[model samples]
Target: MTTTAPAPAEAPASRVMAVPPAPAADAAAYFAARLAFHTDVADVHAALAAGAGDFAVVDSRSTGAWDQGRVPGAVHLPTAQIPRLARQFLDPAVPVVVYCWGPGCDGATRAALALARLGYRVKEMLGGIEYWIREGYAVETADGTRQLPPDPLTAPVGTDDCGC
Candidate 1:
């Protein structure tokens, strides 16, 4: 006997399409600009794994959060300290990528704005440390470093890439 997959359930009419997508050229430009302003956790992990040194990753959360966990090599520069200590802690020549607690927190955005205003090129890391942890990347803590198994909801298990 042969079996076939069931048909997918019909989706509700989307409020998303209520406003039609922008024209292709406009969409391309918008998306490109967005990429310039944001970097995702996966891309950041790949860059770090490759030992790329062109940019700096910054954790913009507080001291307690830093103690809890952080990207392995991220600089512990809380958003409030970006003004006084940014130039001292970071090289002006390097591009900066900032991440905060998670999608719900705007600390990274505030840090990015502070860095940009100080004449440094910066992008906010989308999804922040929350996504970083959720993706099963190794995190550094006061105790040491540890990596969790990939969270199936956020990342592919037993695969090299997400195929996005």
Candidate 2:
């Protein structure tokens, strides 16, 4: 049997598209630092699963927000609480990956700063719990663990993975 595929959808509009490529050295340094400062949900999940990244995942939302949902095993270090309390839950030598509600929020960045000030290496999880749940990753709430179907717009809809 033969199957026909539908036409591809048009790309969405944006004010800024890809910029001209930078020089090789500049590009390399930028991306290397980008990786150093930021990670996405999938990579964080893989790293956590391997159990060897030597990084702590910190949820930098408020107590109410954390209680709403959070990455299982994530340290509940709210940004406001980090300066006074990060050392209580994090190792100085270990790196940290911090997240808040989603890309729309900057609480993770503030928390990262606080952790860094205290001398913990840090990276911010780019998409936060928003994309975690969007990509069907497990989250632990007071009630229990849960996940949702991946949104077709953000994730591959008909396959096990996007193969990216």
Q: In model 2, which regions exceed 4 Å deviation? A: 1-20, 158-160
Q: Candidate 1, residues 68-91: lDDT per residue as tens digits?
A: 999999999999999999999999
- Candidate 1 displacement at residue 66 in angstroms: 0.2
- Best candidate (score: TM-score): 1
Best by lDDT: 1
Q: Please state every model's RMSD to the true fold in angstroms.
A: 7.7, 9.9
lDDT of 2 by residue, 1-164 (tens): 99999889989766565565689999999999899999998888877777856788999998898888899899999898898888789888889999999989988998889888888899999899998888877889999997788888777776755776
Q: How accurate is candidate 2 locally (lDDT)?
A: 0.87
Worst 10 residues of 2 by lDDT: 12-21
Clashing pairs in 2: none
- Reference-based TM-score, model 2: 0.84
